[model samples]
Target: MSLPAPETPLYNHPLPQLERWLMALGCQQDRGDRHCWLLHQGDWDAELSLDTEELVICYFPHQPQRKVVRSFKYSLSRQDVEAAVLEGP
Candidate 1:
């Protein structure tokens, strides 16, 4: 199925569309936990969790001993979340 317009709020998306969007963005769903995903880019890697209320992301090796974590409520527009998230921590 196709995704809604980028301006649409994530809460308006059906689950499958959301999953497809994530996959399109290069996220791999965790084999053990269906709600979790992993992304690896040129210089960074991140783990994403599809929680009930929000999308949570943890960027790895922020300071050698820490990770940078962020969350976006599903109420936000898909485009807004995509920009904020794919932009990295």
Candidate 2:
């Protein structure tokens, strides 16, 4: 049997790829809005916001912060989000 050809990527594949990266790095999507997402990583957390047409990573700076009821537009890449959620300043 012959193998089928690989499918081509559509647009930018940052979300799907970022999802995988988050999962691998033990980051969970606690919650998400139309433009932003909340990620829980170990003892750290980050707020990913999508603004205009770019993804932005806004760190809480303070640790042990609880999730609040907030929503805002975001425009960021999963790669950046994953890195921010996993890494820190």
Candidate 3:
């Protein structure tokens, strides 16, 4: 039940759409009551967190607070992420 074809490029995806897509990707609940969620991928060794106001992706291999951040309106698609780089919360 996912949209946005993998090949599809992203400019900006609404927060609701991105949130739903994230939930479907096994995003662990950080604060479900507050809309904060985190997704971890062992293979990539990366963790991404998103809430109502921000998106943050941290590379475990890097230093702390070195996460990528973006506006809540940022797109969740790979293309958008790659283009914007990982954003801070």
Best by TM-score: 1
Off by over 4 Å in 3: 1-12, 32-35, 43-46, 51-54, 61-89
lDDT of 3 by residue, 1-89 (tens): 35666445343455576666666666655664445565555433345655444555555433455444344234445456544433323
How do the residues 1-89 of candidate 2 rate in per-residue lDDT, one tens digit apiece? 22112131211444565444444655455464655556654555566554555455555645666443332223333344344445653
Instruction: List candidate 1 segments past 4 Å from native.
Output: 62-65
Overall local distance difference test of candidate 2 = 0.46
The models' CA-based lDDT, in order, is 0.91, 0.46, 0.51
Of the two candidates 1 and 3, the one with more favorable TM-score, higher being better, is 1
Model 2 ranges with Cα > 4 A deviation: 1-11, 14-32, 62-85
Per-candidate count of clashing residue pairs (backbone under 3 Å): 0, 9, 5
Give the worst 10-residue stretch by lDDT in candidate 2.
2-11
Candidate 1 vs 2: which has more lDDT = 1
Residue pairs with clashing backbones, model 1:
none
Residue range 1-89, candidate 1, lDDT tens digits: 78999999999999999999999999999999999999987767899999999999999854565789999999999999989878987
Alpha-carbon TM-score of each model against the true structure? 0.93, 0.41, 0.42
